[model samples]
Target: MSTTPMFPSNLLPNEASPEWMNKGDNAWQLTAATLVGLQSVPGLVILYGSIVKKKWAVNSAFMALYAFAAVLICWVGWGYRMSFGESLVFFWGRPAVALDQKFLLEKAFVGMYPTATMVFFQFVFAAITLILIAGALLGRMNIYAWMLFVPLWLTFSYTIGAFSVWCPTGWLAKAGVIDYSGGYVIHLSSGVAGFTAAYWVGPRASADRENFPPNNIILMLAGAGLLWMGWTGFNGGDPYVVSIDASLAVLNTHVCAATSLLVWLFLDIIFFGKPSVIGAVQGMITGLVCITPAAGVVQGWAAILMGVMSGSIPWFSMMVLHKKIALLKQVDDTMAVFHTHAVAGSLGGILTGIFAEPKLNRLFYQVDDWEKYIGLAYGLNSGRTSAGFHQMGVQLGGILFIIVLNIVTTSLICLFIRLIMPLRLSDKELEVGDDVVHGEEAYSLWGDGEIFDNTKHYTEHNTAFDLEDGSSSMKKTATEVQLT
Candidate 1:
C-alpha cells in the first residue's frame, strides 16, 4: 500500500538518464571497453600461454591473467582517480576511491557518459599495460614478485604517464601534446618498463633463452587475431563518443595494421628467405601501436605512410639494431616489447605531430587553438611553421618524459621488489619452468588420467626405457628420451 502511492508514475530523464548523457555514446563506450578487455584476458592469456616454449607456457599465461585481475582491483580502488582525477601535482592526480555510487553515477569530466563508464574504460587500458610488461619478464620472472610489481608499477609509473598526457588538466595536454589513444601512455610505458624489468629480473635460463619456441603456433595466431580485431575498441573508443572521428580511427587502425603486416611479411621474405608468423604478428602490433596516438587525427594516406614506417623501422630495430647495440643485446627482453611498443610508440607520437590534420585534430580535441594543435604538414602548407615546430618539440618532450619516467620508476620498483623476494625465479625453477613454478604443465605427455610426477617426468636424470625391443632391460639417458 505504501509503495503504490509514494513514487511517481514515471521517472524524469534527469533522475535516471542525465540530460548530458548520450545513450549511444554510453553504449559504444561500454562495447569498446569490453573489446579492449577481451584483448587482455583471453587474447593475451592465450597468446602468452601458446607463444612460449612448451615447458614455460602455463607460467607465462598466468602472469597475464594475474595482472589483469590485479590491475582492476587497484584501478577502481585508487588508480583511476590518480590518473584522471583532481591534480595533486603537475604530473599526478590525487588518489581516491572510484567505487562509490555517488561518484560513479556522475557526469564524467570529458565524455557525455557516467563516471562509471570512464572508470571501466580506463581500467582496461591500465590492465593491458601491465599485461604488456609481463611479456618481457615471461620466461624467468618470479610470479610472487610480479604480484607485487603489478600494483606498485601501476601506482607509481602508469598513473604519472596517464595524468601527464590524458587527463584534461595534465601538463602535456595543456601544452598540446596529442596521444589520441595510448601510443605514449600504454605502449611506450609498457615497453620501457618491460625492458627495464627484464634487465633487473635477468634473462631466462640459458637453455630456454637459446632455444625457446612457441608451443602452439596456430593458437598463438588465434590470440593475435583477437588482439588485432580488438583494436577497433582501442583506437575507436578514445574519442569517448560515437562520432565521425571514431569511425575514422577504427578504419585508420585496420588500414595501418594491414599495410604494416604486408610490409613486414615482404621484408621477412627478402631478408630471412621465409615468411614468419611471429614476425608478421610483431608487424601487426607495431602498426597498431604506431597509429594509436594519431589514429583519429591523421588522414588515411598518412596512416599508410605510418604503417610503412612502423613496419620497416621497428623491424630494423628489432632484427638488426638489437643485434648491434651492446645494451640491447645484454637486456633479456623476452618478447621484444621494447622494439614493438617503445620504438613504434615513439615513432607514432612524432608522426602524429607531423601528420595530424587540423580538421581532424579539431574534431577529436574539440579545440580551436590553431597554433597549438596544428601538425607540421598543415602548419607548413598554411604558413604557420612555428606552430608545427612547437608541436614537434612537444611530442619529443613527451617521449623523453615517458622514457625517463619508466626507466627510473621501473628500475626502482624492481629493486624494491628484490628486497622482499627474488625478482627472477631460482635456477631449478627456471630450468623446470611451468611444472616446478606452478605445479602444472601446459601439456601432459602421459595418458589423460595419469597424474604427472616431477620425479618421474622431469628429474635431472630421467631413465629412458628401450621399449621398441622385446625386453625393457635396455635403458637410455634423459637426453635420448624423445617422446615424439
Candidate 2:
C-alpha cells in the first residue's frame, strides 16, 4: 500500500536526536544528573534517618524526601527559568515555565545536550540545597512550616544565588567570580540559609539537644559512602563536556575528600584522643565543598593543600571556635552544616583565587585573557599581580554577597512562613517526636502499629516489666526497652 512512498526521504532533523546533539555528552549528562539525584534521595535520606535519635529518624528523612519532590515540581514549573532564563534584573532571571517541548528539546545554553538535561541536572542541585538546609531544622521544625519554607526559599534565596553566580549574564559571573560548581550557589548558600532558618525555627527540645545520638552508625556510614561516590557526578559534570577537565575534576574531588578525611581523623586523634567516624564524615563533606570551586581549575597538589586546610579549619571551627563564638553557640546547627559547607565553601572560593591555574581556567572558561582568572600565586610569577588581586577581590565579594543574601532572605522567608503557621512544633510534639508528629516511627519492631510507651512500663530494682504483643508479659529494664 505504497508504504515506501508514505514518507518523504528528505525530512527535517529528528526532534529526539538532533544533528547538534552529541549522544555521548547527552548520556553522560543524564547519568551525571541521576548520580547527583541519588546523593539526595537515598544518600542524604538514609544519613538523616540513621544519624538522628531514633525518635526523630522518620521526620528527618521525610524532610529530605519532601524537598526533593517539591523542588522538582517547582523547578519544572518555573524555578529553572528563574535561575537561568533571561535577565529580570542584575541578580535574578525572569520566571518562566520550563516544560514546553520546544524549549526542552532545544540545545542547552551551556552543555551539548537538550535543555531538558541541564534542567534536570540543575534541579538536583536545587533540591539538595534545600535538603541541606533541612539538616539544621530537623527534630523540631513544623512540617507545614517546612513545606512552606521550601518553595519560598527556593523562589527567593536559591534563585537569586543561582542567577547571580551561575547564569552567564549574572553580574557576579561578569565580574569574574569563580564558582566552578556550587561552592557558592549550593554549599555556602545552604550553610548560611540553614543556620539562619535554624535561628528562626528555634532549637529542638532541651532533652533532645542535650542527649541526641545517632540511631545507626553503620547505616550512617553506608549513606555517607553513597554521598562520597555520588560527588563524582557533582564536580565532574560541571565542565559541561566529556573532556580532560571533567576527568581532572573527578580525580580532584575524590583525592581532596580522602585527604580531608584523613586529616580530620588525625586531628580528632590528636586532640580528642579518639578518631571519630562522624568527624571523618564532616571532614569528607568539607573537603568536597572546599574543592568544588577550584576542582577543575587547580592542580593535584593544590587539591591536596585545599583538602588539608578544609579538614583542619572546619574541624577547628566546629570543635573549638563554635563553642567560643556567642553567635555560633546560640545557633543550633544540628548537622554543623555551617562549618562543613559555609566555612569550607568560602575558603574554597578564596583559595580558588589563589591556586587556580591560568591555563586550566582557559580550558574551563574557554578564555585566554591573561588579565582575568589568574591566581594570586601565578599572578606574582607572571607579573600580572593586578589580575590576581582582582580575582581574589571578586571571590571575597561573592562570599560576602552569599552570606548577606542568605541571612536576609532566609530570615524574611521564615518570618513570612511564621505568619501562616508556627515555625516550631508544639511542645508535646517535640517531646514525643516522630510518632506524635507523623503518627509513625522508623522502627516498628516491638509490635504491629504500636510505639513503645515508657509510661506503661514499670521499673523496680533496675528491672522493668511491660506488655508484649498485647497478649504476653515481657520483662526488661526501662533502659533496655527504650528505643535506641
Candidate 3:
C-alpha cells in the first residue's frame, strides 16, 4: 500500500454528513448566532448600561441597541455580500444579497460549511463589529447621529475590512495572511474607528465625567456573563465545520479567556485593595480579543501565554497610559474600546506567529485547496528558520494598515458629519439623558401612564434641587448631592 492513506473513490463527497448535517449545521449556526446576539443584547448592553453613571444609562443602552439593529439591516442588504461574495476585484466580495431560501440551501461554499451557515455566521461578525464601535460613542452621542453613522460606517469601512481578511480570493487572503478569526477585521478595526469617532465627537458633559459611576452593577454582570459565554461561538464558528478542529478552536478560545481573567484578577488584588468586577470583565474581553487570530492555530499552552500578555498589556495601556499620556487622555475613548480591542488585537496578531502549530494549520487548510497551497508556504515545509515570525510580521503589517485606515477614515467621516450637523448633544440635553432626548426611559415601575406621584412623603430628585413633588405641606431642605 502507498504511504498515503487510501479511501473509496466515492468518499470525495462527505457521506457522514446525514440530512441532519443541514439541521445540525443550522442548529450550530443558530446557537452560535444567538450567543453573539446575547453579547450585544444583554451582554455589552448591560455592561455599558451599568458601567456608565445613572445619567447616561439610557444613552448607553440606546447606543448598543441601535447598533444591533442597524448592522443587521445593512448586513442582509449589502454588507454581507461585500464581505463573503466572490471577490470584488480582490478588495471585497461581489455586491448581492443571499435572501432566497433556495439560494441559501443550495449555494456552494469553498470552505468548511454550507453557504447558508457561512452567511449567518459572518453576519454575526459584522453585527458585533458595529456593537463594539458603539462602545466609544456611548455616553454623549446624539441618537439621530448614531443612527446615521452605523449604516454609513458599515457600508463604507467595515465591509472593506471583512472582505479583505475573510474572502478567499481577496487580496489579503491571497497574500497568505491567516486571521483564523477577526483580530484585524473586527477588534482592530472597531478599536481604531471607536477612538477616532470618540475624539471627533468630543467628551461627555463635564458633570458626566465628574460622576460617571455605573447605574446598575447587576445589569453589568449579566452583560459580562453573556460576553464570556458568547465567545464560544465567536471562535468556534470560524471553522464552520463541526469537526475536531472546531472543538479545539472553541477550547483554545475559552482557555485563553479564563487564563486572562485569572491573571487580571490576581493583578488587581495585588495592586488595588480588592478585585473589581469591572476589571475582571476587562480581562475577559482582552483575552477574547487576543485569541481571535490564533485560536485554531495555536496550542492551549500558547493561548495561556497570549492571554497573560493580552490582559496585562491592555490593562496597563487603559489604566496607566490613558491617565499618564496626555495625547491618549485627550482622545476620550468612552469605554476604553481602543485599549481593549486595538491593543489586544495587535498583540494577538503578533503572537499568532509565535504560537501557531504545524498540525492544526494543515487540518484547517485542507478544508480548501487554495488554503492548502498557502498553508504549505507558511507551514513546516518552509525553509526559513523563523517562518512563523515572518507570517507574524505580515499579521503586524495588516494590523497597522487597519489602524491607519480607520484613524484617517473615521476622522474624516466625523469631520464631514460635524460640518453638516452637530455631533454632540446640547448643554440642556446633556444635563438630562434619554428622558428628554428619546422621550423614553429604560424602565417604568409605576405603569399608571403618568409620572404624577402625589404621595405625601415622596420626593423626586433632579439634577440640581430635590423637589418635594408631593402633597405634603411640610418644608424640606434641598441637598446638593450626586445620586449613585
Candidate 4:
C-alpha cells in the first residue's frame, strides 16, 4: 500500500478552514448532538422495548424510532425556524424552511459554528422532546394517531416552548429565565404534554395497566445506562462552544446523577426493605432532569444538594402522592413521565433559582449585568436580594408558561387527530397487542435443532420462566402461551 496523504496537495487555503469558525467547537457540537441522538434511538428504543410488557415491546420501541425520523424531516422543513428564527411574537418564531445550502453554510446567530451544525444539534433536542412525550402515550395509543401527533405536536407545542425559552428573542429569555439546556423547553414540556395527551388518548388496556412487567430487566438497564451516559452531550453541548463552562456542566451533570441515584437507592431500601433497580433508575433520571437547568451555573456542593432532593421528591410524588392524588391516577401516564420528568424538571428550575452562582451565570450567559440573573442564595449574601426574587419569579413563570402551553397545545392536537382517526387502538388491537398490531413479537425461541410451529410463540409464560433463575440457557420447551 502506498503511504499517501488523505487530502490533495493543492487544497485551497480557506476552503476547509473557514475565516470565522472554531473547528474544535464545531466538531464537539456535532459529537454532542450525535450522543444525544443515541440517547433516543438505540437508547430509548431499547429501554421502551424491554421495559414494557412483552406484548407491547414492538409498539413502544417503534414509537421512539418513528419520532426520531419524523422530527428530523419536519425540523429542517419548517419546525426549526418556527422555534429559533425571527420572532413572530414574544412567544413564537416565524416559520420558514431551514434547508437552503447558502443559509446552512453561514455562521449561526448564537455560535461560531455553521448554521447547519446548529440546526442538527437543535433538531436532536426537538426529536428527543417528542420521544419523551411518547413515553406517556405508550401501550394504548394508535400507531396512525401517533404518526399525526408527532408532527402536529412538534408544530404547535414544542416550537412554542423552544421559541419562548431557548431562542434569543424568546419572551422568557428576555425575562432572564435560565434554562441552560432544556429543563423547560424539553423536560418539563414533555412531561406535561405527555400527561395531557394521555388524558385524551386514555389508558393502556386494563390488563396491561394492571400487570405490565419488563420483558428484559438486564436489557432495560443497558438502555438506561446509555441514557445516563449520554447526558455528557445533553448538557455539555448547550453552551454551543467548548469552554470551562462546558467542562463544568459535564462534571456537575454526572455528579448530580450519581448522588441522586444513590440517594434514591438508599431510600428505596429503607422504605420498601429492598433496593429496587427500577426505583434507582427513576432516581437517576430525576437527578439528571433536576440538574439540567442549573448544571453549569451551580457548584459541586449545589449539584450534590440538588441530587439529594431529586432522588427523594420524585420518589414521594411517584409512590405516595400518586396514590393520594385522584388527578394523577386518572391520567394513566404509562411511563410515569409526569412524576419523573415534570416534577423533577420543575424542582430543578426552582433550585436553579436558589443555587445558581453569580459568576457561573455570567460566564454561561455571557452577560455583565449582575442584577439580572443572581440566584437567591448569592443575592442575599451579596445584598441584591430583590434580584434573586425576580429570578425565582421568572423561573416560576417559565414553568407555568410551559405547563399551560403544553396542556392547551397537546389537547388541541389530540382533539384534531381524533377528527380523522381514533386516538386509541381498537379494543381488538389492545387485546392482541404487537402480534395483531405489527405482525411481530419481540422475542422467540427454538430448540437445539428444531424450529417451532408457525402458529405458536414464546411469552412470559415461556421464556420468562427459563430466565428467572438467571441462567444463560434459553431452552425452548417451557409452558406454551397460545397466541389466540
Candidate 5:
C-alpha cells in the first residue's frame, strides 16, 4: 500500500468547511460551550457535593450529573428543534432531531458557524438550568423520580421560556424583551421552577434541614471559582461572535460579580457578624444573574449600579423576606435558588430596562429602534421617557410570563412524578442519606472500611470509641475524617 493516509469516500477535502463559517467564531463557540458544560459537570458537581450535609454529598452531586447527561440526550433528539428550529408558534419551534450531519453543518442563524455549535452551546445552558433547579431539591428528592422530572421539565417549562425569550422568532423576542444570555430563560426559570418543585416534593427531613452544613468549604470554593470563571462563556458567547460587545460583556460580568460579592460580604458582617464564604458566593451569583440580560448592552457604570442593587435586593429577599414570608418559609428551598436566581433574574430584567445603553444595545441586539430598547435613564436624558417605560413594561411582561409558565408547568410535572413514585426520599433513605440511597459514601474513613454509622460517627465521641480492627480510635483520632 502507498504511504499516503486513506480518507473515507464520503469525506470531502474540506468536510469541516461551511462557506459562510468563520473558523475563529466556530472554534470560540465550541470552546465556550465546553466551558459552560464544565460549570455543570465539575463546577456545580463539586459545589453541590461539598455544599450539602456530609451524608447527602454523593446524592446531591449525582443529581447534577444525571441531569447534564439527560438534557443532552433529549436536546439532540427533539428539544433543540422545539426551542430553536422552525417556529411552531410564538413560543415554540417544531420538535425535530438536530443530529442530521447536513443540518449540523449548515449555518446557524446570526452565528457564522455550523448549527452543531449552536446546538451544543444551547444544550449546556439547558443542562445547567436543570442543575440549578436541582440545588433546591438537594438532600431529599428521590433519584428515580428526579430521573423522570428532568426530561419532563426540560420539555415543558424550559423549552417554552427559551423559545419565547431567546429564539429570534419568539413573541417576547419580537417584542424586544432583552435577555442576552438567559437571565429570564435559564436563571429566572430555574429559580421559579426549583422553588415550585420543592414545594410539591416537600421539604428535606427535619434534621437535615435544621443542621445541614457544607461538607467541605474549600472544595465548595473551588467549584464556585470554576462557575465564576465559566461565566466568561455564559454571557460572552451570546453574541455568537468575537467582538467589542463580547469584551464589554466579559468585563461587566466580573465587575458586577466582584461588586456584589463585597456588598454581600459587608451585609453579612454587619448582620450576621461574620463574613460568610457562602454569602459571598450567593452575592456573586445574584450579580451574575442581574447583569446577564443586559451584560452586552449596559455601560460599565450602569453595570456597577445594577450590581449594587442585585447585591442588596436579593440579600434582603433571601435573609429578611424569606424569614417573614410564610410561602417562602413553607417551601424549604435547600439552596435558596429562588432568591439567587428567580429574584435576581427578575430584578435584572427590570434593571435592564433602566440601565440598558442605547448605543450598546444597537451594537449587541443590532437594533436601531429607539422606541424599543432605550433604558429609562437614557430615555430621560434623550427625551424618550415614554419609550423607556415601554421597554420596562415589556420586561415586566416577560417576567410575568415566565413565572406563570413555570408555576403551572412545574406543578403539573411534580404532581405527575408524585403519581408514579414519591418525590421525596423515604424516611429511612433520608435518615441514612447517600449511603442508603446510592450504597456509596462520598468519603471513606473507617479503619476497616465499614459503612458509616451516624450514632457511631456524629454526636458520639469517636475519639473514645474502639475501632472494629481492635485499634484504639482515640490514638488514631488525628487521622480520622470527621463531619461537623
Candidate 6:
C-alpha cells in the first residue's frame, strides 16, 4: 500500500499564482472571522442574555462568552493540531502544532489552499461549535465545570469529527463524503453533544419557570444580525482559499437563509396570531445551520428546499414535537440546539445525497486524478445528468457515524465530570447571576454609585426590604431589581 503524505508538497494551484494572494479573500477571511467573533462574544452573548430571564441573563451570557475565550486558547495551543495536523487514526487527526508563518503561507492540503487561511478558517468553526453546545447547558451549569468540559470535549470529540470529515486521510474523506461546511462536524456533533450535556446537567430553578421572559429584545436583535452576517465567512471561507466557488458558497448560504425566513414567517402567521422576533431569529439560525453541510455541493433550488425542511421541521421539533414527546421535554435544551443544529445538520447531510451535483463535487475537489474522481463519482448534474446511490450512501454513513459518536462521548464526559464535582451550581447562586461567578456583568447603566442593598431601590417600587428576614418591611418599597 502506498502511504499518502500529510502535507501536500504543492497546492492544487501552482505555488506562485497571484490568486493565492488575492488579498480580497484574505480580507474576506479576516472580516468573516471578526463577524463570527461578534456572533459568539456579543451575538450569542447578548442573545442568551436577553432570552433568559434576568435571574439567568448574566449566567447565560457568561456561558457563551467563556466558551468562546476558552476554545480559542485551546484551539491554537493544541486543538487545531488534533483536528488538522495529519491523519493518524481513521477517525481523527494526528497531534502537532501549527505555529509558523511558513506553514500558513503554503498550500493547505493536496486538495485545498494556503495553510494559514485554512487554520484561521477552521478555528472559527471549532470555536463556534463549542459556543453552540453552550446553548443547551446555559443557566444551571457551574462555570468551573463548564471550563473543564470545554477543553475535554474539544480533545475527545470535536477534533475527531473535524479530522474524519475534512482531513485528507480521514476515512470518510477517503470514502468520498462531502461536507461543504460543517453539517456533520459543527452542527450535528455539537447539537448532539449539547443535548447530551444538558441531559446530564438537568434543569433551571423552579422559580425561573414561572417567569422567563427575555430581558432585552434590542440586544437580541443585534446578536441576530451578527449571526446573519457571519455566514459570509462561515460558509464562504470553507473552500480553504479564495475562489469563485467560495463566492458561490456565500451566496448560496444567504439565499437559503432568506428563503427559510420567509417560509418561517408564513408558517408562524398561519399558526400563531403574531410572528415573534424570537421565531424569526430561530428561523434565521436554522436556515444558516441547515445549509452549512450542503452549501457548495447542491443547486440553489435544493438549498431552498433544505431551508423549508430545516425551518419547518426544527420549528415543529421545538414547538410541537418536543412538547408531545415526553422524553424530549425531560432534557431542557436551553436553546433548541438539537433541533437547529443536529436535526438541521442531519437533514442537510441527507439532502446533500439527493441534491448533490457531481460536477460541483469535481469543481470543489478540483479533480486531478480523473480516474480517482470518476471511480468515486455518482452521477451528473440536473435531470439529464446521470445519478448514482454511492455518494448518497457515503453521506448517510457520515451522519450516522457522527451521531453515535457524539451521543456516547458527550454523555460519558458529562457523567464523568459529575462524578468528580456536581455540574450545577447551588440553589442560592442560581439567583445571583454572572456577577457572582465571573465577577463581570454584561451591562451597567449606572453612571455613579453602585446599586446595592444599602442604596435605595431605583425605578418603580419605592421601598426597601429588611435585611434580617426574607420579608418586605417597608410597605412602599420599590421592587426594581438592583442593577450592578
lDDT (CA) per prediction: 0.91, 0.90, 0.76, 0.89, 0.89, 0.76
lDDT string for model 5 (257-322, tens) is: 989999999999999999999999999999999999989999899889988999999999999999
**Which candidate has the top score in TM-score?**
1
Every model: Cα RMSD to truth: 5.4, 5.8, 6.1, 6.4, 6.5, 6.8
- Model 3 TM-score (2 dp): 0.85
Off by over 4 Å in 1: 1-14, 368-371, 449-451, 455-484
**Lowest lDDT 10-residue stretch of candidate 4:** 470-479
Q: Can you give the TM-score per candidate against the true fold?
A: 0.92, 0.91, 0.85, 0.91, 0.90, 0.85
lDDT of 1 by residue, 326-404 (tens): 9999999999999999999999999999998888988998756744787899989999999989999999999999999
lDDT of 6 by residue, 1-484 (tens): 7696554444333446434455455666666677667767777887888888765787788778888878878887778878888667778877766777776677666433466766776777788898899988877899889989998999899999988888877888888777888989999999999999988888877666445688888888888888888888788777656777787788889988887787777789889978888888888888998888878776788788878887798888888898899879888888889998888888888777777666676677775632222212245442332324666678889999999999989988998898889898876566555655655555554447443332222212533454232223322232344331
Ranked by lDDT, the better of candidates 1 and 2 is 1
Task: Report RMSD for candidate 4.
Answer: 6.4
Which one wins by lDDT: 2 or 3?
2
Clashing pairs in 3: 43-223
**Candidate 4 residue lDDT tens string, 386-472:** 998999999999999999999999999999999999999987678667876787777775566443432224444444443333212
Give RMSD (Å) of candidate 1 vs. truth: 5.4
| TM-score pick, better of 2 and 5 | 2
Clashing residue pairs in candidate 5 (N, C-alpha, C atoms within 3 angstroms): none
* Tens digit of per-residue lDDT, candidate 3, span 1-484: 6798665664334644423345455567778877877877878778887888765777788788888887887887778878877767767677787777666666346433456766677777887888899888877887778887888888778888888877776677766677888999999999999988998888888767666777777778888888888888888877766667778889999999988888888888988879988889889999999999888887788888988998799988987778898878887677888999999988888788666766787766564533332222355556544565556666777887788878877877787778778888876667656656765555543436553232222434332323223211212222112121
Candidate 1, residue 104: the lDDT equals 98
**Total clashes, candidate 4?**
0
